[model samples]
Target: MRVIAVWSIKGGVGKTTAAVNLAALAAREGARALLWDLDPQGGASFLLRVSPRRKASPRRLARRSVELRRMVRATDVPNLDLLPSDLTYRTLELELNARKSPSRRLAVKLTPLDGHYDWVVLDCAPSVTLVSEAVLHAADDLLVPVIPSALSLRTLEQTRRFIAQTRSKAVRVLPFLSMVDRRRRLHREGCERFAGGAEGFLRTIVPMSSIVERAAEARLPLFAVAPSSRATRAFASLWQEVREQSASPTD
Candidate 1:
C-alpha cells in the first residue's frame, strides 16, 4: 500500500482540501483509500462529513487492548474510509516525544490498517513539530502544496532541508502549486519560472476557484459534486500523476 501525506509547513495552502479530493479520487479509481486525519483541527474529517471523536493519545493507544484497525469508519463515498481525529491529538507531540522511537510510533500503529487500504492519505498539521515528524515517518511519500509566491517557496526550501536533515526514508517528496491564479502577473510569472526550472515535478497545477470552497461548504469531494469543473479536471490530472509516481519502482 502507498501512504501519501498531504502536508505543508505553511497553513491555508489547501493541504486538507487536496487530501480530501485526492483520496476521494483514488477511491473512485478503484483503490481502497483511507483519509487519516492527523491534523488536530480535523478539517479532513469535517470535509469527509465524518464527525470528530476524541481518540486516545499515542500513549493511550499503545496501552489499549483494541487495535487501531477497529477504529476505521466508512465515508458516504464507496471505498473511502476515514480515521477521525479529535482535539486530544493536539497533545500528540508531547506523548510521542516521551517514546523511545517517537518518529516511528505512528507507522507502527498503522501497520494493521495497511491491509485494509490501498492508499492512506494523511492530512498533516501545519507544523514541523514532533507530531508532524511522526506523521512524516509513517508516510511513504510527502505531497506539499505551495502557493505560487516567494514566501511559499521559502517554506518549500525549509521542507526540503528538513527532509534532507532527517534523511527520511520517505521515497518521494512532490511539491505542487495550490490555489494558482493565472490572472495575476506574479502567479503567471511564478508558473513560467517554475515551469522552466522545476524539473522532476508534476505539471498539473491547482487553479484558484470558488468550487474548492464550495466543496468545503458542501462537505463533499469536488469530483463527486462537480465532475466537469476545472477543479475536478485538475484533481483528476493530479491523481493520474500520483498513480504514476506510486507505480514507479522506489530506491
Candidate 2:
C-alpha cells in the first residue's frame, strides 16, 4: 500500500482537510483506502463521523498488544475505512520511544495491511515529535499543506531539510498551497511564485471557500458535499498529481 502522510510541523495549514479529501477521492476512484487519524485531536476521525473507541490504548497500540486491524472501523464512504484516534494518543510518543527502532514502528505495524489497502492516508498531528519522526520514516510520500505565507514557506523548507537529514531516498515530499485567497495580495503573489511546479511543489492551489468549511460542519468530504466546487476540484487535481507521482519510479 502507498502510505501518504498529510503533515506539517505548523498547524492549521489545512492538513486534516487535505487528508480527508484525498482519502475520500482515492476511495471514490475505487481504491481501498484507510484513513489513519494519528492526530490526538481526532480531526479526521471527527470529520469522518467515526468516534474513537476506548479500547484503543496508546501503550497497547504502540507495543502491538492490540492489533492495528482491530482498531479499523468502516466509514460511511464505501471502500474507505478509518483507524480512529484517541486522546490517549497524546502519549503515543512516549510509548513508541520506549520501544526499539521507534522510528520504524509505524511502518512495521502497517506491514500486515499491505494487501488490504491500496492507499493508507495518515492524518498527522502538527509537531516534530517522535510520532512525527515515525511518520516521516513510514510514509512513502509526505503531503504537506502549506498556506501561502512567508512562515508557511519557511516551514515547508524546514520539512524538506528534515527529510534530507534523514537520508530517506524512498519518501517524496509534496507540498501544495492551501486556503489560498486570490483577493489577498500576499496570497496571489505566493501562488504565482510557487505555482510554477518548481522545486517539487504541487501545481494545485486549494482556495479558501465557505463550501470547504461547510464540509467539516456537514461531516463529509468536499467531494461528497460539493464535488463541483472550486475547492473540491483543486483537491481532485492534487489527488491526481499525487497518484501520478506515486506511480513513477523513485529518483
Candidate 3:
C-alpha cells in the first residue's frame, strides 16, 4: 500500500477532511483505499458513519492480524473502508515501547494487507505523540494542509523539522493551502506565496467554500456531494498531482 499520512501540528486546519476526500477520490478511481483513523477524536469515523469504539488494546492489535482486520469496517462508499479508533489508542505509545522499534509499529500492522489496498490514508491527530511519530516514520508521503494564515505557519515549520529529524519514509512533503478565502487579503497572499515556494508543493488551494461545510454537515466526501464545486476541482487536481508524482523516481 502507498501509505499517506495527513497531518498538521495545529488543529482545525482540515487535515482529516483532506484525508477523507483524498481517500474517497482514490476509491472513485477504482483503487482500493483504506482510511485509518489515527486521531483520538474520531472525526474520520464520524464522517464515514462508523463508530470509533475499540475493545482491543494496542498490544492486541500488534499481535493479531485477524483481530485487527475484524476491527476494520467497510464504509458506505464502495472500495473505501475504515479502521476505526477509540480513546484506548491514547496509550498506544506506551504499548509500542515494548517492541524493538516503536516508530515502525503502525507500519508492521499494515504489512499483512500489502496488496489489499492501493492507497492507505492515515488521519493523524494534531500532536507530536508516539503514534503520530510512528505514522510519519511509516508513511510513504506526508500531506500537510495549512490554513492560509500567519499563525498556521509556525505549525507548518514544526511539522517540517520533525519530518526532517525522523528522516521519514516520506520521500516528499506535499504542502497545500486549505480553507482559503480569496476575499481575504491574507488568504490570497498566503496562497500566492506557497504556490511560488516549491515544485514538489502544489499550487491548487482548497478554497474556503460553504460547499466544504455542507459536505461535513452531510458526512460525505466533497466530490460525492458537490462535484461541481471549486473545492471538488481542487481536490481532484491534488489527487492527480499525487498520482503523477508517485510515479516519479525518488532520490
Quote each prediction's TM-score: 0.94, 0.97, 0.93
lDDT of 2 at 191: 87
Worst 10 residues of 2 by lDDT: 161-170
Candidate 3, 1-251: lDDT as tens digits = 78888988899999988999999999999999999998768899889998754555556765534455666889998999898776776766787777778888788888777788899999999898878778987788888888878788878889889888887674477788888888999988887777844544576788888998899999999988998988999899888877776677666
**In lDDT terms, which candidate is top?**
2
Tens digits of per-residue lDDT for model 2, 118-219? 999999998988888889888999999988898999999898888877765478889998999999999999888886787688999999999988999999
Which pairs clash in model 1?
Answer: none
TM-score of 1: 0.94
**Regions more than 4 Å wrong, model 2:** none
Clashing residue pairs, backbone N/CA/C < 3 A, model 3 = none
Summarize candidate 1's per-residue lDDT along 80-138 as a digit string, tens digits.
98987877678778877777787878788888876788999999999998777777788
lDDT of 2 at 34: 98
- Model 3: lDDT equals 0.83
Model 1 residue runs over 4 Å out of place are 53-59, 62-66
Q: How far is candidate 1 from the true structure (C-alpha RMSD, Å)?
A: 1.8
Every candidate's CA RMSD? 1.8, 1.1, 1.9
Ranking by lDDT: 2, 1, 3
Q: How much lDDT does candidate 1 score?
A: 0.83
lDDT for every model? 0.83, 0.91, 0.83
